[model samples]
Target: MPLLSADQLTIQRGDRALLRDFDLRLAAGELLHLRGANGIGKTSLLETLAGLRRPAAGQCRLADEAAGLHWLGHRNGLNLQLSAIDNLRFWCGINGASPAGIDAALAGVELPARARRRACRSLSAGQKRRSALARLLLQPRPVWLLDEPLDGLDAGGLALFAALTQAHLAQGGAVLMTSHQTLPAPLAARELIL
Candidate 1:
């Protein structure tokens, strides 16, 4: 079964119709990349799929509601006041994951022990982005909706994301994301241009 299916999806902002008459299906073990110019509603499209917004038209269906989803938007979605470890702890608690994996998740994103203890506000932009990405490893959800997921990453961060995403796909999880950059080599994706 498809992880997510959207039929004739329409996206709008205020009175402006950004995109219309779209269709998409994301299958398990697959990745779909959304390509478009800025300000063309890629974020809105992702929000609609993640169930954060109602589509202007059409509907979206997820194969398993209990399986849940992971959403990474343009913002890192970190609490600047909290340390990386603490932020992940809170996410783990909310997502029904064990806090024990926090250290491993941090390490997966290449965050060092010292930086993990520092406040997110004190970390560099790339570190903050990595901290946010670590949440994806906190729990196993069947679907991930990411918008501009690699916006601030350096080469190492990019490589790290590729490895993490590849693993997720290997486990039959699906991803629908928007990125201007090409997906790392060896990670195949079907693209939809808006």
Candidate 2:
């Protein structure tokens, strides 16, 4: 059975149709890459799948009993005042996941040393993005809805993120990420352009 499916999905923002008759089906361990020009409703689709935005018409179904989802948007979604670890802990706790093991999560993104320190209000754009990604990992969701997840990462960071995503998929997790950069060579993914 498909892990998740969106049937005839439609979304609108103030009478502007962001997406119309959009359909998607995700199987276990599947990754669907969304590629589209700006203003094409990729983010709107992700938001709808994540249950953060209601679709104007359509139905989304989660097949698995233990199903859950995570969403990362264009914004880093981080608090400037909290340290990376603290921010991760907050998200994990709210999501019913482990809150105290964020050090390892930060390490996965090559930000271990920055874990204890407050999110640099003065940090570079890349560091802030990494901090937000660290929080994403701390939550244990089976589905990931990522919008431009590769933005701001350097070469090595990009490789690390790809590897992490691959590992996630290998473990029966599904990913729906939007990216301008090409995916890693071996993930067996498909891109759907809106």
- Please report the candidate that would top lDDT against the real structure: 1
For model 2, what is the C-alpha lDDT against the true structure?
0.80
Summing lDDT over every window of 10 consecutive residues in candidate 2, give the lowest-scoring window. 114-123
lDDT of 2 at 25: 93
TM-score to true structure, per model: 0.95, 0.91
| C-alpha lDDT values of all predictions | 0.91, 0.80
Report clashes for each candidate as comma-separated counts. 0, 0
- Give the per-residue lDDT digits (tens) of candidate 2, residues 41-147: 88888888888899999988877647577788988888778877777777787778886667877877887484458665756667777888786577667788899
State the weakest 10-residue window (summed lDDT) of model 1. 182-191
Q: How would you encode candidate 1's per-residue C-alpha lDDT over 1-194 as one tens digit per residue?
A: 79999999888899998878888889999999999998988999999988999988999989999988999988988999999999999888877899999999999899978999999999988999999999998888999999988888898888888999999999999999999998876778999998
